[model samples]
Target: MATELNTPQNRVRFGEFEFDCITRELKKSGRVMRLEPQPAKVLSVLVHKAGEIVTRQELIRTVWGADTFVDFDQGLNYAIRRIRAALEDDADAPRFLETVPKLGYRLIALISSSPNSELEDANHTASLPSTTLPRLYWVAIGASVLILVLFLAGPAIISEFRRPSPQIAEPVSSIAVLPLRNLSADPEQEYFSDGMTDELITDLAKSNKLRVTSHTSVERYKNTRVPLPEIAKQLGVDAIIEGTVMRSAGRVRITVQLIDSRSDQHLWADSYERDLNDILKLQDEVATQIASKIGSHIISPTDARMAVRDVSSNPNKQPIRPLNIEAHDAYLKGRYWWHRRGTEAETRGLQFFQRAVDLDPTYAPAWAGIADSYAVMAHHGGLQANEAMPKAETAALKALALDDSLAEAHASLALIKFSYYWDYATADEEFRRAIELDPNYATAHHWYSHYLVFAGRFEQALSEIQIARQLDPYSVSINTWSALIYYYQGQYERSAAQFRSTLELDPAFGPFVADDLARVYEQQENYPEAIKEHQLEWTAAGRPKDGELLRNAFLAGGPDGYWRRRVSLLKPVGRSGIGSALQLALVYSHMRDREQTLRWLEYAYQEHSPWINFMARDPEFAWLRTEPQFENLESRIGLLASGTR
Candidate 1:
């Protein structure tokens, strides 16, 4: 509510709720509630108003920034709504947050900035109805004895009994790690929290028993106002892990709690603090405890000093070494940006990763990061395959040499071997090894799905992509690939619908999704829709289609003229990172011009274009699948030996 305290304070309690100003987190009855960033700021401003009614202008200046816009009223109303929901304050019967019509709002709940403030709160609530309680009131709800005994003797009583207590919850099969909130004063330290979240997820997922959700899947919940039960349900996870990371004065502290989402029950919670130098080891300790609580092995892996190191060739491999603190910090920042995706973000990520390796060349994860950046650059068509893949392979090889157990490095190596060298055998082994080491690694499964589809293992590909989607349900790339799998399998209607659904989730995907949808339309022989979708793709990509030219060509010679016009319109530039050569080949194959298709296919082969890997499975190329020249190109790509040709 409104604060009367004059001095600045780190934490304050108000009406059974605790607010951490630094972390922007609110907790009621010891349970964390989702308060969005905007609402948190509004609440903060109200708390600082010294119990006075905060006018609209005051709120706008303090919470919505100095630049006033036309929508400030709407934005303020939304924030107030969110704050009320989070605090469970009814506008009709306001208890905590209250609105003042024709003005702004006020926090009526008493704010306590001091430790002894609870006494003040008690005196204030004493005159209210029995329904009203002290601000610091601790209610023991359904699990009263468990709380009582825990306060007295704690969970240790379970060991005192011969049989397990009924209070103990069954071990959950799946869990999602919500993004760790950054409690540091500086906002730049956000990457530290994100990186810690990723590390914790990886550590717990190492357990052969646990099905941990991917960071990409849970990332959408960062600073979200959505309720935990709903978030957990969307993720399809049995339990949820929520936490905060605070860094200050060369010291780090992490606090985590596990919640059974279905019942909204707290299973276990703990906090750890250590010098910055030991942050990596501290992370491992937190993971170890959480793993134990989840009914998994007590020790998950090595020390951040804690990842893969095993290799059969070395019977007694040296234990993975602890990382240099600065390098570890840099590496965390690198991964945060990498997770952001897109060309500019990945480039920024690569620079940070380079800094990491320069600071500590022995850090295997940094080398893996380097491999990932280059590999992604190639995949995004930001760099040529020959240029990017070689660098990726070199870095991945170095990482493996340092610590062969790195699943991320192995996955990166696997993609390079398949997409670049066309070494199917080695790629197969690498992908398997990566998954075996970390079965919950969603990207490994997602990439493996691509290989399966291209190799004509439709059933296996479907299975793998399903698993990938399960682990990373919110990931756009995995969803896109899932749709493409259907397209490759000739399930046109399903693929079209899936692509549309994915595009709905990620509108930025229009440039790519529309292109794929165009193919589905073409396959269905829906010429008008196909042309419209293709035009949408071009316009979204900043290359507006010549609609009149396209329509005229289609009218003159049907699908054949339309495809010929597309070939003429094709630029030297690639589309959605696939080489123009491959795009041309697609057009020619559609026209059933075997000679032109073969010529462009050969060009794609010589360029080592990444899209060439899909030649065996792309339905457009089916017409030319029997041509001698196409067969020769496939043979060169090692697809013949693999039998996919």
Candidate 2:
């Protein structure tokens, strides 16, 4: 049955939204929505045919007409995606729109709360435009010659398929891959989706033509209700890639769409399905297609299509090898936990990585995960460096032996070499090699920046850290390093500003950077601001009483009393992040008690505090730079000769 609304009343309402066909306007709660002409036309057609199937070909003819030819499939899909975005609809469990597999689309939302609102004439709601109508100039042909005439039009029909898609736009130079939704509707499958997100980012980053935001950065938007343009702005990317992944039985399916961040327009969309065992090849294929669509990674659209076709025809193309699926699963689980960031999280990550290796001892990525987990554990205080560093080294070497091309393995190894072995030259080589292998690895840039800062190469460090920030702008650690490096270069004003900017950028990131900012204020001799920041830090650390006590001490006896009070409150170091010996050493350094400062430094060194390596770099220790014990300690750690290793 044909459906229609009162003419010029030419409007329909669904799910709190009202659409006017004549005006081509969509509004929610009286606020007009952005619905471009093309997408608006598509929506009008669907709304008029509410609760009915609109076949792909029928919609194409009605909307584009025979005279205005284009890549019909891509155009239609882009239009549908834009409409869905406007309606805030989900493809998997749509509220207003639904996809009819192998058929077309159906406007499933109740219109004007009536099912029998029908009057199907072409002009009922919004008549089809002339450009959308098919012309039949030779329709009077005789039956016997009709078949011959259609056969003669075969070339033209094929040519119709090659028309340029309207979705094409100016190529974007950068993009962020938001975490893919888990379409399995099972929480257990979240790891699979997250793992796929990481792999997609990794593969896309391989294109020198584009900058792919770090997975850690985009994961911040996984389930948040933030606006798309706002997310793009925060990520500082030209485009955004959002998608969904589903795994069923032994097969996996993924659907992704690219959007222009500036206009929130759907620029391109594609879907891929593959056997679970060949997921690696499937990921590479998807990445290649997306990269080509967004930049000059594949030269041109024609070249992109040919390259995809050649994946099967080209003998040089690598075949899809069977993966040790269980081991791969375990490795993914390891990564999922590793990103959680804490002593307990690292322990869980280590367990899963160990499980992966046990399942397949030669799985290089799994071994690399093991190395990373151990290395982080050391830094996070889950284990003493002396204990974790050796274990990290072993796993890193094993991963390297298995796959020397792995950028992640090289990075983990390089960090360990710098942090423990103090092999400055080798560490530099490894860091460069890791970046050369995968220039988009943000952690490599982040860590290398630290090395450069320690070596007093402030310009190089600033450049590397900025690159890291560009790749992972939302990463608290990466942002914090930029501030720290600035402080190391004696640019106190810049350092304080960076710290304050990072805090304002994400209040959730404030906790990680509050202490750093507090120290920066201390360097400025702004004791009041320093105390205020430290109090916030104490409160965030779940020590409100301690924060109040410190404030009271500052009120009573000024900076001297505050340091003395902190000295009394100092507790021996424990497992992980609690009760750092370095904090006490800094407090003693503030009091200018050389004997106490040296005593606490030795204690921090014994406890393997992650900050021990940078003891000499602490601004608070600047007054005691001439102390022999301090210089002797620096020499003992391989930082004496050139002050960096």
Candidate 3:
């Protein structure tokens, strides 16, 4: 039935364009235009049903076919984009074709049958070689045309015609918003300026036309004396935004400039002063103006309307909901501490987020931040799973209840589902939904990659992590996690290279990096390097004495003796938490002591350790796959249902 709708037509015309369905060619203003096959097919379908909504499913079935093994959504979107580009049609103010959001596209231009439809036939025929015409005759014809043009227009006309027109500047496709300088007399107000910078990045990132670098990558440049071009080069962006934020009493002023990084030229600059309560409005105005100057298409009709609305008269036009000054301040502080990523910082961040929600109960972002903090604390072993996961889920649900469109909330909930509930299917769906809502949200991609790796989908995991790296290239966590994914996939050399690259970015992450590298080297059977890396990890963790003892044990006993020493040391600390018990199990597995490995694994299961989830894919446990006890443990933990490596 869908094939009937795709039946070839003789010709189709809309606006100044004509498409020859049989020849699969397109023309505008009597000149041929290059349209790729997929785009041309998509255009033909939209033209066939000019005024009706062509659903995405119909387009996929018609163009891609139901059985095609491709990413249907991404492929269809690319095809539609190509069609819009060829037509010079704006998705925001479409004149020829209009997108129907969740539905497919529609041809908005009026279509009519043209009497000159034979033009395509004539053009095709002319493109063929004329065997009957001699070479001399063709040369004479070309000479006559040149003489006629010179005789009619003169030499000056020829020179003028040959002159090139002034070139238009290319649209900025990528940008980095540097940390806003705090110009307040009090230095402690740095949090306010940092918060404002983050807000502007968030607002600009919503535009699908622009690839805005994540806040984590840009934060490193705060107070640095790096040249604008150098900073732009490091961030790998076409443009840079530099600003100064000043606050006095209940009023704030922000001065910002958009610079062309290659030329160091000011593309646009402006300053805004408003009451602190109107800060959200000011941020929206700045983002809208910058996007306009950079020629970024408004992402949606709602965004377009909000951008053009007279905010002075109708403040509700601002996309960001209004927040009380105190609540906003607290939320910003929370985010600052959250970015630090440590037990103390997380605890402090949680307190500030709670304060923010207390001040403004309806603030969805604050609730989302609360959920993020709780999820991180639980995930990093800073808090018990039972104590932290429930609170995280509740806060994430509340945030979604307030604003279902918050990608951060959705991502936070997805993390909870993946790590705590072990609901792989639901977690995968939530991660996809979050990414669909905001493709630029790097955290979603980063976390989703981990989920994929855990599910033994290494190729998909690599794909997602690559996107996250592009968005936040210098993120230490993302870089390290990318290595971790490779490690799980058994790509030891690649995992080592990635870990080394991550250490180059932030050497302070040495301990974590060393731990991962040690495991990778051990897997490669490079025991010496593995032992050295383990020592480095221990020293970085502030246990030089333990490092020395471990090194001595390795020297005296080799791999077996070293692992036995590790198991003995970890056994005493087993009462502290399930983590030590799991570590002992892992060491026992490495020593090839089936009895000891099974014993500690049973202890971990009895303790209800969250680390039990890793048993399915952790290569250390591969040797125990045939064991009945291991199968039973994995089955009970729900990993068997999800598949194992």
Candidate 4:
């Protein structure tokens, strides 16, 4: 029999399981199961009430607090799944967990404890509350796992324990290198200056001591009205680097400053003026100096060797004449607008890239920039991949033709291979090459994570995303994508919890994450929670997909006229858009309207809409799975019960 202990410090225990009410960690058989932070909290409550039934309403309020407006079931379900996975129980069978039907779940394991030890641990834990435990546990973990965990203590503790902590940046392990602004009056020579700024950031990224934010996030700060402290705070960086570029005739001059964000003090500053031929060496020297002043470790021989390959050192790359400054300026302009991510800005981005290439046809990076714009269009659904991919491929190939060492060009090509061709093998090759060329290329890690998820490699996917998270620690966009990976991997409860955490950081991401939460609830047969989340999501998106999906959740023939009206509104306008039609069929099928369901199902298959991939896994289609039409459709779509593709 496993020894049992209950202390004022410890909440409960059963068998080898221990729930430290204060710490919110579930240790089973003496091993920590890396539970996503929130689920660990929900489990803490359940462990305390082990023998008694925990009501759904009570659990929701306790886990999510009273002020939260969102539906809590998605979060609750995710918590249960994470806890269950940790317990190593079969989801389909029952041992420690017993679903009490409509009321709630009850933990069925018998708990036994020795009298003396239980009293001591409980007393130790009694001095702490659940909220305080998370921080204390993190401090313990951080002290062991990372040398600089104290810097992230406040933010990490709040995110983990769901309460605000001290407001201070941890010792900085991650930072953003903003572009060096051009102070020169000769606006025409701005490109040469901007190019130097970008090159310095690239050089510094090779240092493992710092995780640099991607160029997109840093570009938002250029020429902005925000103060350095505000910019650093918003980006969650401990320090910031600013610089200015000036060029006269054919020579270039650069000035740089490094600021300690917390104290608003200038840590280091430097000035450099050099000829066109010395530009590359100047950038490398600036990066080295900044690293030295900012307490970064000595640059490894690998980094030094790579920097030595600069064009300034290897004169054979370009002659020391007047540089093509206009082309470099155009490229910077393209990058500036590209980061804005709007439809019109995307169009302007292409114009800038084209102009850069026209002025300097041999400019490999400009071609890579064009490839990036096309890839963005494909990603945002503005252009179908078929149209966007060819242009992306062409531009990437051109960039590689001039500079095979260009990481961005490899990333652009890798995107096409992953998104369109579904060629995981080639996509892996391209991404690996991109990282090899520039180990600090965050996009390579981000995109490869998606490939890992779709290929059913969940552990690898998490590892890749962890690297991306290190690079873009404060990017709400990257965080949202991380949640999506959990959702697709059937880790709904974990996914839902992460999505909720993401929304706290970025309210604008709420609508999308809400829709995702509704999907998770519906899959779990939690209809009431599903409907409420769908309602919230529908209002936020103001889109037909959400409302239409919600309507399906309620179309169980209880109200015939209501079902008919909802169906009419949801039906797709055009015959070609079969995705919408599929939604209508699902609603009708649930409503017992067999004739309409079969009709739309036939139409969906014929249109080859991607929605057909859901047929085998969709809970809505559970009834239809035994039908001959379902088999035929599955066979035609090449979908199997096990994820075929």
Cα shift from native, residue 626, model 2 (Å): 2.6
The candidate that wins on lDDT is 1
Candidate 1 runs further than 4 Å off: 1-87, 90-170, 304-322, 504-508, 545-557, 573-579
The alpha-carbon lDDT assigned to residue 358 of candidate 1 equals 97
Tell me the spans in candidate 3 whose CA falls farther than 4 Å from its real position: 1-168, 297-322, 569-579, 599-611
Candidate 3: TM-score?
Answer: 0.69
TM-scores, all candidates, are: 0.76, 0.75, 0.69, 0.55
Candidate 2: clashing residue pairs, number: 1
lDDT (10s digit) by residue, model 1, range 320-382: 666578998999999999998888899999999999989988788989999999998988777
Total clashing pairs for each candidate: 2, 1, 0, 19
Question: Candidate 1 versus the native: TM-score?
Answer: 0.76
lDDT of each: 0.76, 0.74, 0.74, 0.63
Instruction: Write one digit per residue (lDDT tens) for candidate 2, span 1-645.
Output: 322333333555677787765444676755556564557768877876777899999788766555432446766887898799889899999999999999999999866521224432222334333322111111111221443454356422111111123354566888899999776745798998999998888788888778889988898899887988999998898898887776877777776767788766656665565567767767777788788776546221111111211123454633323477898899889989877777788899899999998988767788889999888888866788778989999999888876677788999999998877777788899999999978889999998887787677879989998999999998888999899887876789999989888888788876678778877887787878877777777888788787678779988998887777777766655563345677878888888898988998887776556567776566778887778888787787777775453
For candidate 2, which ten residues in a row score worst on lDDT?
300-309
The CA root-mean-square deviation of candidate 3, after full C-alpha superposition on the true structure, stands at 20.6
Clashing pairs in 3: none
